[model samples]
Target: MAETREKLLEIKNLKKHFRIDRKHTLRAVDGISFDIYRGETFGLVGESGCGKSTAGRTILRLYDASDGEVKFHGENVHARKSKKELKSFTRSMQMIFQDPYASLNPRMTVKDIIAEGIDIHGLAKNKKERTERVNSLLKTVGLNTEHGNRYPHEFSGGQRQRIGIARALAVDPDFIVADEPISALDVSIQAQVVNLLKRLQKDHGLTYLFIAHDLSMVKHISDRVGVMYLGNMAEIATSKELYENPMHPYTQALLSAIPLADPEVERTRERIIVEGDVPSPISPPSGCRFRTRCPFATDICAKVVPEFQEYKKEHWVACHLYDERYADQMKQ
Candidate 1:
């Protein structure tokens, strides 16, 4: 499924496998498919090492794909396009990384760091315009223009993240892949940054693939969400459908772990604590990659890989138990 319309990015069966040894390889992102519609926030939520970040990077072509295709605005991104063509795509898509402190270059001042992409993309024809643009972006991310002269080391972690966001927007991209943007910040600062992101998206009419392990944040910012596990998507649905009617066992397990803000709800919530460490991506389980920890796994789950298919209108799941027609048989 290629990306089309105002849909800025689409990925189909995208895979990124890393060869660990002569005989072993880790399927970091294995055949995941999804589309990011125009001006909407699509969140990817999963546990660590589940390839959420890898999927994002691979879609952006930061890592060469082992298989599958990535389309940007109706064009095949992986195809050999001209430098100008690729640059055009790059300008429309940008990423806000997980960590602000580490993602920024230590040697460069905030102004220079943000200006780097603008300069590379030649976004500004002159220094004055570049400065004005940089300052405006800085203010948009809730930082002062004067702060741009300071180095990244001079700010707190959250402040640095704000700077990182400023840098990503410097290129005036239409889509932003915000990889766990709030996870590293303090609780107090997290909401501030998130609100800033929401405001920016509203004012700029930007689209996003908001990646996070924090389910609550994903629900707050995302219009739709995809739950990934062991390099495969377990389910995809509207934020409301996913939270209220999660069908896949993995999705249910994830929601069970989220601490409800309300006291009565928290007490009533059946906290699902899946025992055992995550299965190694080195050689994921044969059928459902999540079958090892899934409570309902059976012989068929271990024998055949479940296809990610739509079970309801616009809601897709990969578990055999939710196969719709075969659901009763699976339960029996």
Candidate 2:
């Protein structure tokens, strides 16, 4: 299915770093590259501080990339452009933030909040059109017209996220960056929001970069999944391929930790316990970032960084254990 579709966004060697001091710099997103295909939900999953959010923001051009190119429909996202060009670019892409509580303006009514994009882009011709558009959006996101007059503080966490979704959809974007959008909601509300996203995608043919730490939900929502470790992409493949046959040690450890529903399978499965805490990104370990805690680490693991390469069709991994070129030395 992904083979025939065009690439919506191509991220090449993308890096986002913050200068902490003269001697140290935090590498939040360090040289990771991937393609998000049209009309597919590409999931980025990792630990809390593994730079998943940073990567998403960089791809969206919300953060200035330190290195690399993000091409959106063959146009370089980070390149200098006129205000009109930038506005057009922004209209084609939108972001659904992680925290709904913090994202929405507490003082503004829901109608005004959702129409901010419409007003900015000049999508509506007049106040009547704007009110109509806002009301329609509220209904589209499962809220009623009456809810539009209320402030963000009046809604539940789930409803607030719906309003966020409505705002993103208000712009009629081709691509959306959903950065852990469901992470802040209640467990029951999470499913509802996820279902809403799926429905919206089908209805609007929306492409999404869904970033989160929840493997179970990611597996459920993603067409393809990329696992990140300490700002490095460890593995990426189709959701089925990644879950059924994860090639990297970090991916293996992550999958093993997901609790199975069946009691027998849960009891029989071997847990791949990753030892030690994740190293600081400010001074990330040299060579392979995962080498410090990788179960298959050898001397070469510390001496050289493993290249991210495809082992099989659509399955990519970065680990010395899977590199055929190092097979001989790994035996020692």
Highest TM-score, which number? 2
Error of 2 at 49 (Å): 1.3
The TM-score that candidate 1 achieves is: 0.95
Query: Candidate 1: what lDDT?
Result: 0.90
- Models 1 onward score TM values of 0.95, 0.98
Q: Which stretches of candidate 2 lie over 4 Å from their true place?
A: none
Candidate 1 residue 85 C-alpha distance from true site, Å: 2.6
Give the alpha carbon lDDT tens digit for every residue of 1-332 in model 1: 23454667778999999998899999999999998898899999999999999998888888899999998888887888799988888888899998888899999999999999999988899999999999988888888999989988899999998998898888888889899999999999999999989999999989999999999899999999999999999999999999999999888888888777799998777777877889999978888898899888888888888989997988999989967655665775
- Which 10 consecutive positions of candidate 2 have the poorest summed lDDT? 1-10
lDDT (CA) per prediction: 0.90, 0.94
Candidate 1 Cα errors over 4 Å, as ranges: 1-5
C-alpha displacement of 113 in model 1, angstroms? 1.0
